[model samples]
Target: MNQDTPMLPSIEPATLEWREGQPVSARFGDVYFSRENGLEESRYVFLAHNRLPERFANLKAGDTFVVAETGFGTGLNFLATWQAFRDQAPSGARLHFVSVERYPLTSDDLRQALSLWPELESLADELCEQYPPLVVGNHRLVLASGDVRLTLYFGDALEALGELTFEADAWFLDGFAPACNPGLWNTSIIEQIRQHSRPGASLATFTAAGYIRRALADAGFAVQRVPGFGPKRDMIRGDLPPDGQNTGDGNGSILVVGAGIAGSLLARNLADRGRTVIVADRGEAPGTGASGNAQGALYAKLGVQFNDQTRLSLAALLHAQRYYPANTPRVWHGTGLLMMAGSEHERLRQQKFLQQNEYPDRILTPVSAEQARSLTGVPCPHGGLWFPGSGWLEPYRLCTTLLDHPNIRTEFGFRATRLLPCNNRWCLSGEGRQDLIADAVVIAAGHETRKLMPVLGEFRMKAIRGQVTSLPSGALTATPKAVVAGTRYLNPPMNGLAVTGATFDLHDSDPQERLSSHQENIAGLESMIPGLLSCDDLASSVSGRVSFRCTTHDYQPVVGALVNGDGRVLDGAWLFTGLGSKGLMWAPLLAEHLADCLTGQPAALPRSLARRVDPKRCLAEPVDTGVPVG
Candidate 1:
């Protein structure tokens, strides 16, 4: 898929009405919940039928349970389940709730609809705060201090469910009335659900249609009819009997090499999902590599012509914009970003990006020179593209914050030099000595990863050095209110300092800060904003940092299972390197994807985008697994 491919159309927001003070979907011509008492009806139909209260109470320490639902109308069921899990679940237990919605309600609609139930206000507000866009893909929201996880797939039910990689512990079959929305209850969707269900998994639905019962039974469920809530007399419930089918939730220990943003994010992802994670780094602390930069810009790097690289970058940027704020101000700043039209060629490219894609203004808007200056509080030479959700953050702060999770342990100065597999486990050794042993290992040491995995050389990875110059805020006439990027970037001031200038030197490994590169950065900055800074100010500036960034020829990160020269997958081994300069934007998304691959959870990206970053894509030879690399 390329830029010429049409953008995935967003799901139309549900048009809702009021029926006896309860919200009703006009499209389906059905009430969202029982008009008699929506809260009680939800409790009776979903929670009671699924035995959630008992399950929550029985969860042992370090256990994780997943509950999947078909329709996430107003997120009432999710909130109810979250509240129950919070009130009754074991202290260290985790809850993963996955839901699918074809037509999601707008934020305003959800707020208005949920207002009827003041009892669910807390959870509703949390959901609203992290609500995702209406795009056709997955949005994983980690809530309640990383204890409750919500994965919302917005698209057709069958297509969305078919892409998921995890097995559900319980299913909530609630997609309007089966008669009104038969597509969601079709045999194919049911079969997909069955295939993605863990053995002994139970399902509950407020409908007892004969065909539904027969279809579920035919798919290997022990179906039964139970009393329904409200006026309905009967509801359907089923259990996938054990019979050696259940794949119990057991996440093994994982050792992540490199404490940079990539490794930190991967550790957080694994630890949040109940896996014990050990992070090892060659340096004395985290973010000592490229991720140690004072400030890194976060935005989708697009080209005049869209390619697989641009698509993956866009997806990663979108997910990062939404997910990075789970820990705001302390780690990130949502001050917005601006890409200046510094050159005529880039101005034309920016115009093409806007004309080719009908992106939401909030995501990317073409701003006039005057508008850009007013919005950013800086003098601008030309109109540029503004990303309201994009911003910059200190990479080290964010990496450390992510590693603060209870399930994550950090081993600084423990450089992993070799990955040796023994007895179905991986032993990561550093300097000819075993440093850590784990069931799985991920090599994420940026450019240095090539030394640990020689096969990575086949992918043509390069280490490019970058230097960023920082100046005291007083050096500028006025501080920019947002990040301004073009040939260089002038980030919003933080702690009385503003940062700009990153000279991308290909094939350079020197970490020494250079005055020549600093001058080049200033030249680029002046080219972007004509009179923003004078040569005297740049000459006086002395603070800067130089770090090595890893990149691949295709400009895509290498993720997924690591394969040997013989075209065999190294079991329990993964590679997550080659992020290059976009580490800030790509780390969180790819880390989550790697976590999903390891834990057998739903992938957060589409197959097309996922394949573009597959570790096997750059193989010297592509093997025919007949599995399309998904």
Candidate 2:
């Protein structure tokens, strides 16, 4: 699962031309679908040949059917498959569709193309609503009221399939004609397709060329020619032998220690996948740890040097943009954010970060002082990078929502100080609670995670205490339209209060409110925005919260399976903490990853990038996330 990928390219939208109401790809010089019978063509070539209808109907409750596709052109094929699965599959069944697209249709274009079928309008509307920005990365969407999951990779098909980790039961080997877009049908792609296929997995393609059939056979699939749909004469379908076994690696009833963002998200993800999950916390409530901040900004601390940390941060930010809006948008906002130029050091970092990473303006765009003022009502001194889809949210409220799944249970005031093996399961017991038995356990209790490590004097993670003070909006002369951050952050007023300070104190664990911390926050704000806050701000009515963030010595999170002193993963134990101050940004995607590891599903990120956060990453090879773009 190493990600040796090139700098991600901004997706150039597919340009389309209308030919008698049929959409044709300008780049590939191919029709997206047949104007005559595209829907039936999809049903005939993919669903029927792949045996999805019969397979879907046979699925037991809690079963998931995985599908991968080479091209997501117009999404007609996917839509057709989705409808068929819902029609055939059991109520508790799930469909996970993974698709790769080099040139994605703009959301507007997707809507227009889908509008051809009035019957699919409802599902089409939902897809368009959750379609991600044209950024090269994985965009996973939870659709069909959680019955369908779509993980769309907006990148080259071969690279995505090569790096992507999933065992697909079926594959729609689709794209433009091989005569024109043969790269997708090349040996590398065919090999990756076979590599990712599950034993007895079926594949269907629109082409019936002899070489394609030969390649499929050579790749160990039982290949055959089939009658095509509509004007096409023939297609191909293939199945890998059952002996080609590639099995799942995750499972069992799980217990998550910690009710903060990390544990709650992990519990929720597992519960969504039908795993029984119990969340235990020392506090009486969720997010009452590091995630207890009154207001938390949903952004990342991007690096000036593009490294694994930077790549991870960038990926987390992009995934978060789609995740929050789709899952918790009601609890937060994407109004935008401005990281103002603060110190000479910070200004240089911002300039270098922009120059080294040439991302699309939608992800980051620089603004002038005047533009900054226009965007944020009262900003004049400096201008920096503008994160268009970043904002702040109530962290506790988000945690509460994530843990509300039907299959997830919660235990508050459950301090887990001892973990013991019992009958192939794990026993979690500590003060204030009885021993809880779970098939597996994940320690996500912030800094307290270190206390649970079996082979540890100290588990390479430390506590960094932070405090944030909230000032009522009535006390401020001006409020920003968006969140603002530099040395400190300023959130847009919510419920008549605009939140400001967060003193970063290293190696400290005091959880008490302090007047000095309040004064320091106001001082930093006044220094960043000269006239925005009165000097007497400390005297005005203000309240605050203090919490400890758990961070690794290297500052990456401790994710993946919990490893022992000899580097072997402990049986029935996993760790999902060490998010530091970026839990709001990191939890969404990393939680998806840890859940995959714990549940034996495909990983959300490749191991190269994931290794940065892996508990025993130093024992692994060093990560190289390609050169800086531009």
Candidate 3:
């Protein structure tokens, strides 16, 4: 399918009319109260029927309840729930409200509708602030100082419910009346909801329709008719009979293949969450992937105009700057980085962006060659945009630090041959005779994921073999304080050696360990820093490593749930690969995102951005271009 075509189903808005102090509507042919009545109906039918105030008071400290809703119209239900939770629930208890909305109203409409609740102004304001970018998929909004979390699924109600990985303690069946919205009241939807309900999960809705009650009863819920909220005569309330059997909460174990930055960081985050994680790699040690380089620069290449890649890169850069640890051997020097101004057109674009976006002044500054030398401690013929927050990091050391987590187990020389999904777990076969069973698995093994999982189809990944040459620090006029970029990138001395030039070669995948590429790297370095070093000086300092870097056409790292044929993620099978060269900056944040999704916590990044990183996204949509090999 092309980009212009919709990948998923879409819905139309319901028709509305004002009736007897209630705004009524017909959604999917089902009658519903659009505004006033809908808001009040939710407050009484859903909240009151669940006995929320009493339940909230009884919750233990730090305990959280998952509340799933059939529909999220105008978000009145959510706002009301938040208000009640804040007022009645103990400070330590958290309220997680997950709602499915097909046709979400625009921000303006939501704001106007929310204005009717004068007493709920504070809670409404919090909701409006993190209302998300309105793009499809899951959007998590943190409210009440992060105590309450609202996860909005903007798509088909059934499809959205399927994507949810949480077991609800309560359910709000507040879609349009059963007759008006048969899709919401159908047996299939009820069965799916029941599948995600924990024992004793309570449910309530304003309609006591017989079909709805029957569907609920058939789906394991004990249903009953109750006094309706407001002027209505009746409503429906149900509960999942207590199992009295605790199916011990299973420990979610994940096997992350490849110990590069991506896998190591993934291990770190999982370990932090008290998960038993194993990082497997064929190499003798970690960072033996493309991350074996001595020093790698950190900065986003600002495009002429902000495209999707540029926006993603900018967000990734900022996220890295804020979260990536600074105290590690990865030296973070505030000495700034210089992106040499080449063409007149490019310089103008940079100038325009500087005017519009208020970037951190201490981080980015436009400078001339003279100013650049004064700040960088080295002379340069061309001036460029200086990014002070950007600096060099020892990639191997960062990878090691990330893998240093106590719970992370690293097994070397374990090359995975096949993955089989069996009985709610993944069995990974390799050098070991017994298959390794895990609740989850992340394939951070780069371009090799395709070979491992043929079912993934074709991914837009290129294994670009790169070789970097290191020049001795003594060859320079003065040890450069900052990293210099253009056709070639030169970093300041780390351990008396300056590293530069990773000549990207797509024709070769086998590790050749070629001298020609090292010579090309030296030549490129000389062009960047004129008269600083001779061929002999550069070649003498040429002592760096080489590895294949896997990248996608869009340059965004894949990081999320892996969809499988059985409507479940092949037991524990997952992929964290295709990071390519930007792994240094992208791994930490993306790892956290994957960890959050696995733990059922609110995602840290925007839903659109998260989908862009999802491994399955490219499976459905093909990427037609390759980013220029740097």
How do the predictions measure up, each by TM-score?
0.93, 0.93, 0.62
Quote the positional error of residue 166 for candidate 1 in Å. Answer: 1.7
lDDT of 3 by residue, 153-255 (tens): 7778888766666778888888776666677777778888999888989999888888888889988889999898666788889998887974222347788
- Per-residue lDDT tens digits for candidate 1, residues 350-442, read 887776555656568789999899978889988899899999889988888889988898888785667788789988777744568999889
lDDT of 2: 0.82
RMSD of 1: 3.1
Q: Which ranges in model 3 have alpha carbons more than 4 Å from their true place?
A: 1-250, 326-334, 343-349, 355-358, 432-434, 454-456, 534-537, 563-571, 620-630
Question: Which should have the higher TM-score, number 2 or number 3?
Answer: 2
Task: Tell me the tens digit of each residue's lDDT in model 2 across 46-129.
Answer: 999999999999988777789999999999999999999989999878888999998899877898899999998888888888
